[model samples]
Target: MATVHNNSLNRLSAGGLLISLGIIFGDIGTSPLYVFKAIFNQGTVTPDLVIGAISCVFWTLTLQTTIKYVLITLNADNKGEGGILSLYSLVRRRAKWLIIPAIVGASTLLADGMITPAITISSAVEGLAIHNPAFPTVPVVVLIISLLFVIQRFGTSIVGRVFGPLMLVWFSTIGILGFAYIDKAPEVIKALNPYYAIHTIVHYPNALFIIGAIFLCTTGAEALYSDMGHCGKSNIRVSWIFVKLCLILNYFGQGAWLITHQGNVLGENNPFYAIMPDWFLFYGIIIATVAAIIASQAMISGSYTLISEAVRLNIWPKVTIRYPSDQKGQLYVPSINLILFIGCMLIIFVFRKSSNMEAAYGLAINLTFLSTTILVIYFMLRKRIHKLWIVLFALIYFTVEITFLVGNGVKIGHGGWLTLLLALTIFIVMYAWYTARKIKNRHVKFDDIKKYYPIISELSEDETVPTFASQLVYLTSANNKEEIETKVIYSILNKKPKRADVYWIVHVDVMDTPHARDYTVNQLIPGKLIRIDFKLGFREEQKISLLLRKVIEDMVSKGEIDITSQYKTLKKYHIPGDFNFVVLEKVFTKTSELNWPERIVMELYKILKNFSLSEEKGFGLDSSFVTLERVPLNIPNTGNLQLRRVK
Candidate 1:
């Protein structure tokens, strides 16, 4: 068995710009499809409204996406990786209370993935309605989304290659189309000035509500920031120059078109498609649909990555993850895919048209952005930046994002509650899981291994005891190599007096780095007792069966303990020794005492525990050779008289 797992993210190159184009820009790239329509949907199209909205869109992208995420937050990388969790890893030790925001941010990001595909793709598909107002796009949207989810099991390794070029074409064509319409309403360019954004907020009626629609322009910036590791900060930063230009150019062109029409009410025709020339209409619609599909795929993949990281951190229940494409960080989670599919389908059915989804769109992501802002501020503080500068950064971002949150808050009555509910559910689960872990840790007691060493060695050679196997391996949670769990000691010496030629303890330590993998071995007792500690990155998967075999092979090469079967007949034939793994499964014992908070959290943890992957499966151990032992959680003391013989 070979033991190598490298999750090195796709790094920078000439093509790096393209992969960044395809992956990083998916959610934001497709924003042009519905942003203008959303702006016009809430009210009439007038000069102040149009210009003010475009100005808001311009600066929002600049300050939020450009200044905050691209320029500043991108600097907060963990081993070239960037995300809410990755960001938290930088400052978690500095402030333990910070985990709450990280949890909320990750939860909201997960919620955003479910709605992003529904809204972005639906908006593009809805473009066909311009040609024939009667076109039913819901069914088409459903089919496209369904197909996207269906293919996830196979992995995105093969299809991911083309994502970059297709996105480049997407940005280029849309940029040109927007440019073509610029001359028609050149005056809209004045809207880029900040005064218009402020003036609209100061004077426009129900301006805050309308700002909700403007907020759509920068929703993808968060997702882009999360995907930084895939293409590296350099690639993303470089690509965004072109990508931002294209986005801004197209946005200005749409503004130009809206200003030219100058009707009291903009009709059902979308400004995104309306800007397209009659000759290019068919091609434009096709291109838009394809871009939407790519964006949807990126969102689905991001969701999988988010949950996978959460599982590694124990903030989420463990679930089976598959490497469909084996392209570095690419992964497929069947359960998450199904959940997102159902959620997307439900949104499609409930909202029906892309127009109705605007209210539901930006609500949850605002929380995500706000959460990231909080985390980033703390992260900057830890870097020992000047207090004055940190204050300024926090003030600027909080003002921008808090305003967006307020704007998006108005959407709640209309449809925002849907995403909020989903986000809340996810947040509770994460918080509960994380909190329960802290509770469980408080009760975990480890005993020094020195006292048990002699006993373990004696048992290894006990002739009267039955041999469990040639080797007995135990997976331990004890962080110190010099310590062992009492339950494991009980199983070995007192429970059954089982024996083996050698005892091995394996401890896996999940590291903060994204792709790290290394192991250290300690021989507490030469030829009889050994410990192997595996240090794995959060992004890497664990396959103990294969890894253990590799360890054994290496040890044999170094002339460590032999693994040959001891029986003379088998030894003569050169048969390999048998290895047995013992797993300790914990359950909350009724004998334990706890407060309401602890009890509730533990019970919820237990309920969620059932949904998680089994210990053997999660560790990637071969279950056939594994025997699970149920151990009661720490219990309160029973008085000595309780054991007295009854008269």
Candidate 2:
């Protein structure tokens, strides 16, 4: 059994709590940096507009961020995992059509990954220009980004330790600042009223701008769902309440400051930092920079986890993964990290400032939010959660979300196309890779059962065969008759007669969602040989071994196999039998007939296939009873060496 850390209930230590705060809260925590400022600076500073914008921000947080995520979506956790994929897993079987929305949601999230770091760090670095007008913001931003990427090789554990205390201080500072300004302009607090928001939007001439402005307040809410597994549902829930309280206080404080210094606040350049006294400006800069980096860290780490889940589900190409800490689910993918870093740097260089990047930002975030809303509706339907409730919630949320999407849609000419374009590109690549792999696997058939049944039965009767013969298991293609004939031929040629009471043809189906439990079975073939297949639901985090044992027990009880007698010598009953398995692998050499993209995708699949689970564990066979026999099968195709047809 894996070591279970005491990260639950009272067992959680101070260190763990702090790390969770920093790593998980960074994205949402930093929203205060530009969210309110973004809304206010849209060329409308009138009392009605300010009141309306703040009101919209308030309701967006209360209803969309707090109510939807903290209350509803968080409850939808899959054994403590969250994200669009996790949500999809919970209802995919019952609502498979939901995959379309899930895919769109995931695609938009990928777009967010590329742009968030750029906007965040650029916004923070822009603060430097406030202290010294001569300081070069672009170069400084690039330097910070470069340093961030350099440290990714070491992983997040060391850095995570500092996140909690720093954010605690940051929030405290914002709250204190807000209190200072609230004493002077207390009426700003009244913006919390929903009526003020509705009134401002209705009475204001060009009220539609509030749609884009409200979208800013809920920017990182998806992170709440995506990182749900890293920190358990309870940790996030508890942490969020505190986080939200702090955020609201700070926003009110900013509004109060703006009210007190009506015409004297700094120009559009640095409104967030402008409210601080001169004595505190340096300190604020340091904190803002650190907070920005931390926010980017959350997105970076979340992106790695998302890609890992995608690879496991066969929606992404396989990349190497490394876990820096022994902590469960703490993983690092180097390839993804580098890609994100380079993309972010390019975005910063190309966009040059946060103002330009902001136009590109909302499109990705809004699309992702809209997609999640759609998926949540499907989830409600699958669970038979009342249709009236689903429709009512969906209509309200969808109308609000789509309104923001349209505002973002208006940004298409102004850098919004960048995010949409990136999303589409990734969607195409992922869709193509998935389609090609499925097509290739479908065409390649495994051997017939009759061809191998007699041999397996003969092997079962051989008493001379050792009780435990090998240490790995291999599976034959379930569709290749020629491969089966060759395997029989090779067994006779080698004089070993391929030994194992059970030889499995294993097929792993990576569904779109995380699984609640692993699936295993018996009698895929029957008495002579047991064909075991493992099905992993997308949300399940447990390794294959535990699930395999459960399957064995179920099979034994059903009289599918006699484990009781097989383990008579052992004190406790356990399945006992020496089993050897062979896997048939094919190496495809592309011919002229195949398309270039198909060939490229196939080659990538081959590389990914190398990283897949070994047949022994994949089929649920005990290590003592498994043996891997690799046999290669080749097929003829067109001479272009790009296209191949299976006959």
Q: Indicate which candidate wins on TM-score.
A: 1
lDDT of 2 by residue, 126-228 (tens): 8778868788988888888888877776666766667778988877777676666666667877788899988876777656555675677788889988876
Where is model 1 poorest over a 10-residue stretch in terms of lDDT?
A: 1-10
Instruction: Report the number of clashing residue pairs per model.
Output: 0, 29
lDDT of each: 0.85, 0.67
User: TM-score per candidate, in order?
Assistant: 0.96, 0.78
Where is model 2 poorest over a 10-residue stretch in terms of lDDT? Answer: 1-10
Model 1, position 142: C-alpha lDDT score: 94
**How big is the positional error of residue 550 in model 1, measured in Å on the Cα after superposition?**
1.2
TM-score, model 2 to reference? 0.78
- lDDT of the structure predicted as candidate 2: 0.67
| lDDT at position 627, candidate 2 | 44
Candidate 1, overall lDDT?
0.85
